[model samples]
Target: MTTLQPDILIAGAGIAGATVAAGLRGRGYSVVHLEASTQPLDTARGDHLGPRVVETLANWDILDAFFAAGAEKRLGAKWLTPEGVVIMHSSIDDLPLPYPFYVVLNHDLIATTALDLAVTAADYDYTLFRPVAARDISTGADAHGGVTEVSITTPEGEAVTIKPRMTIACDGRSSKIRAACDFQIAHTYDYEKPFVVLFGPRGELQDPRNEINSYMSLNGGVSRIPRIGGQWKIGLAIDKQDIGRWKSTTSDERKALLAERAPALGEMETEVAGFYPVIRRESDYWTKGTTVLLGDACHTIHPARGQGMNFGIRCAARLFDFLPDPTEMSDAALVAQRLADYEAAVKPLTDAQLSENHERGLHMDCTGPERMQAEIPTLRAVAADPDANFRYRMTMAGYPDRLDPK
Candidate 1:
């Protein structure tokens, strides 16, 4: 086995991992990024990047490239009844934010674009190993003892040992690195509503404002988001028992099912993408020793609010804030300390958002008046209260840190 040592090791090349890899490389950090999948990077989740993510893109010098790659901008979002009656509408146009619009693009496009831009950095000195899987992870002492070493296998059937100052696990919900490090989940909430994703040509619905229109009722909910290239991405909420029926359904049958469950989206012809479980959970700890967890590896939230990718991107940015120029630091202990500091500064925000998301998810996927009864009053009250509305807009727009209530 060949042994390699790098300043940092990032396991996974999804949006979260790519964001961290690109951002760190732009800052002159030496990193080794590993991706277990030999297939091209394509995911069904996280197409909507909240507004604040643009700041990080700009900082990494990829803002123009990001938009140039067919990303669409959305000014705001609306809550409506399935019959097209608006219940609540929130706009970011008046917010005090660096960017006033969220972006919509394919999840794969974002991940690949970020990594592609990272290599173009003048001081880029990182290695990306694709089809490389971390087979073994050994943590010394305790969770705080950090990782002593990781054994990875490459596509070429060669074995390599990696020792790093720090290791970040961004490998999604079932992270091998997180499991190997023995991090336990302290809080978890499995949302009763499950959603199936769909994408198709923009129907007769005229969206001059380019906003996310979410239709909710006793039958269910349909969140219609505009995609680049004049298409629409739909998230159709369904009951838990329907998950099995959805899986066994044919494309045409799926259409009929949509019509029955979410009438607002059923009329539009769209292809079924896949099912995404709505589960909100967080690990008991984010960092141990020189090891850290990020994105879905540490915390996951409901997609109803569209904050999963946004929060992950912000976590990467916040981690960079707590870290020094890698060249200025080489001590493993110091790296561990920075990891602890990063978790300290970011976890509280994540916990609060996850809790709120859990509550909101409960009101979705209803088949009766309970959903309306639970949601209408809350939505109307928020809209009636300017301060509450402003805060809501800020949080939903990906500016939780800047929520200054008047």
Candidate 2:
């Protein structure tokens, strides 16, 4: 068995983990990241990155590369009727932030970009173990719950033991580190309808300003998210009872159903990406001793608003703010204190986000005329009112407090 020691050990090389690794580079810290998958991650994951997520990328020196890689800009979000009548719209063109617009790109591409830079761009010592799985973990003897060591087997069948002062779990919903640490789930909210994701040529929808148009009606909701190169990612909410038929239907049949449900879209050549039944969940705590949970490992929410990746990236940046320098890794008590501080600062905000997203999911799941009579009017009102529209836009841009006079 080979033994290695690093200042930080991050499990999983997805967006959250890669962001943490990239942000930590040039900070005089040694990092070891492990990825169980041999190839790249699924490309069909969340693609929208909010303004705040772009800001985080800029802070980490990743914005230039992201855009250069064909990431597109979305002005804002809009709500419309199935027949293409606009109900409400929120544009970030006037936002005071540096990067005022949202970014649309493949999730795996961005994560891989960050990981590529994390490994090669900086002079810091960073190691990535691909096709390797964490087989065992041992926590400290104290009650604070820090991990002492982790055991893994490399692709070459070599046994390795990693010892780090701090551990970060970004291994997605079924995270092994989180389970091993015994983080209790505090709450969960499941959406009533599953979303069918389809991607293909943009057809007549050629405007970037209309990229995030959401159509809600008595039938259901269908959203058109534009991608770079004149492509569209369609999100259609499927009834639970009709899901079996949807599964059995051909590609053309699914396209027809989408047109029937959302007439504004008409018929377009597209491919079904995947089906997602979203569930919002949050853990009782995000930190224990020197171990911290980031991204889907700690919390998950509905993807309708495209905040999951943004929240994860923001969490990593916030964590970087609390972490100590390489020289301070030996101070176990101090590290533990900092970990506690991180949890205390971030958990409440994350919990609040979970609640808000759960509410939005419930709102999006509505069918029939009740949504039009009740909720549609309120949304239109919010859009029509200047101050209300500004506040709503700011919040959706991930800067809810920017409106403060202070």
Candidate 3:
């Protein structure tokens, strides 16, 4: 029905995409963001933002909006034993960062709020193609060896070609653009089990120690995150094979299952909200000429630590850091260099985070009937050791293992 071209094209309007679009608009760059789903993809996922993202939000001048979106302050991480005894907790309260608190806000809120802020930004030039998807891509062989144009299909069965200086694929793990384009997945670590999250009201679940809690027993573990509306998010680790069986669980069956595994989580009267598979995958090269991968597109990791979305936001920040001056436009070389510079600064950090997450998933993803009970004492000791505790708090506080931009 209509045609539009912009300086930058973003696929997927999730937190990462919206952050990139919003941050760039503040830098006076025109952007186009595409969303495949007709409505916002609201899932009970990525609700925790560590201090890094909290600081990043403030830097982008959207911290107020993020807080206004109704977020519960996550004081720190707490790991509980089967009997609900606190085994370990490293309070991030003392972290020397600008934001020392982790805010638990739902994806829909932060993401939609991000888009809203982008819309009201000074001189915002953005176009949204909802319920549309990129079906194919055309690439050029010259300066940026980047995508020339992407053919997207509208909901009404119309195809349109839009060209952009840079196309950012922020479409999560199953990025259609990354699939259609020439990006290569250099490394992939797929879990035998995916992280499954079930949501229900904060009914009668005993909350005497009502903190963001990880309830682990000998019979697999579940994490309970308190949401804005007295709702609790139940996170489960389901093996890859049992994915369908778990997804097909009935409403009552879900409650029963929740009561069985995470009895402390009260009852889950509602059906499963979402089941997300955990995988750590990164492209060999995030930027190829004019096209660059952002967010989960570049590094899709397990929810071991709460750094997935934070990492994606960092990517957007680095892109904001390296965006070329508007007047430097037609110099394909300049655009290519900017793209490459962002990637150069971001990819190494992503690699380290991805590797670190892989290890965390292996140790923390103990879903067997027998909990990692035996390792609890050792872990408790580590939590008690002054140096080890500092290190743990530092890492758990969202400190980057490597801060080098190279």
Candidate 4:
């Protein structure tokens, strides 16, 4: 078994991990990223960086690459009532930013691009190893609190130790590193409404508009988001136990459901279908000594608002801002302080977003009498005020303030 020592050790090479690696390297921090998979996972979910996220990417000077990797630029978002009435609409052009409203790209492509940038950046030094799993973590007392050592097992079953000044966990919702450090996470999993997602050719659907279309009723809610290559992504919230019923529902049954619940989608060619359980996890404390948690590792939110990855990207951007000066402290101390500041700065914002999204989900998925009651006020208000529609649109796109740092 071979051992390697680096200034910093990162777990997971997803968007959060890749973004931090690239940013830290640009800031002159040595980083090594480890991943358990040699290739990208074949998951339908990907990061959808909103306008604010785009601004941060622009600052890193890599937004163009994201666009180049088949990201569809969104002009605005629209909210529709069950009767196919447009309640509100918001455009990206109104936002004061360097780029367009937002870019929706495949998650794998974005992560791969970020990783590629980090590996090739001239300003910093870094390394990437895949098929490696972190099995153990140890911390020792130091003048500045302590140092962390991580043990990883490669695909070949060889164990290697990475002794770094500090370690950051970006390893997604089920994080081994967070568990190893004994970090406590306050969380809630809403099994009431699970989701089934489908993806396919855009031409297979009716009224396949480029804009994001949200259809709401008392029984549930469904969203159809357009993507590059004439593709469209569909998500519907249903009872967790009923997920099996959806699977049993023939393609014709699904099409019929779409036609009934979402008439705008007259027809669609589904290429794939997936199921996801809704979960929300947050840690009151995101750091412990030389170890810190980031991205999904630190917090996991419901995917209703499409803010899961967006939140993670924002966390990484904040970590970049709080990075310590290498000259003023040892590598270990620098990493510790940076991790502390990262947690302090990110926790509050994440908590607020979680609350907001949870509420939004409930409002959008109202059914029966509740749906009628909710739509009456929204529809009446939109008709009464023209600006009301615009404001609603902006709110969905994460308006007013961009995701960029304040």
**Highest TM-score among the candidates is held by which one?**
2
Q: Is candidate 3 or 4 superior in TM-score?
A: 4
Question: Please, what is the whole-model Cα lDDT of each candidate in the order they appear?
Answer: 0.78, 0.82, 0.74, 0.71
| Candidate 2, superposed: residue stretches over 4 Å from native | 202-205
- Residues 2-74, model 2: lDDT tens digits: 9998889999888898888888878898889998887777777788888988898899888888888878788
Report the Cα lDDT for residue 379, model 1. Answer: 93
CA error at residue 56 for candidate 3, angstroms: 1.0
Query: By lDDT, highest first, what's the ranking?
Result: 2, 1, 3, 4
Candidate 4 residues 54-121, lDDT tens each? 87888887788787877667777666776678765656666555665678777788888888888888
Query: In model 4, which range of ten residues has the least summed lDDT?
Result: 397-406
What does candidate 1's lDDT look like per residue over 1-406, in tens digits? Answer: 8998887889998889887877775566778889888665545677888778887878877678778988778788898876778889898777888788877778888888888866566677788888787768888853357777888877778888988777889998888888888889887787777888877665444665578887766666667787776777778777788888877877677677666645766667777678877786688999988888888888877776777778788888888888756775467777778888888888887788778776666656454677767778899899899989998898887777777754
Tens digit per residue, CA lDDT, model 3, 1-406? 4555677889988889887767675565678788887677575778777777777888888788877877667767678875568888877776666687877788888888888887777677877778777667777864367767878777667777788777888988888777766788888887767777777665534443235777766677778776665777777787678778888888777766666666655444665778776777877888888788888887788887778888888667777778788667556778888888887777786687678788878765667754466666767997788777777776665665622223
lDDT: which candidate is best?
Answer: 2
Task: Give the TM-score (vs. native) of candidate 4.
Answer: 0.88
Candidate 2: 10-residue stretch with minimal lDDT: 202-211
Write down the TM-score of every candidate: 0.92, 0.95, 0.87, 0.88
RMSD of each: 2.4, 1.8, 3.6, 3.3
Residue 34 in candidate 3, Cα distance off native in Å: 1.9
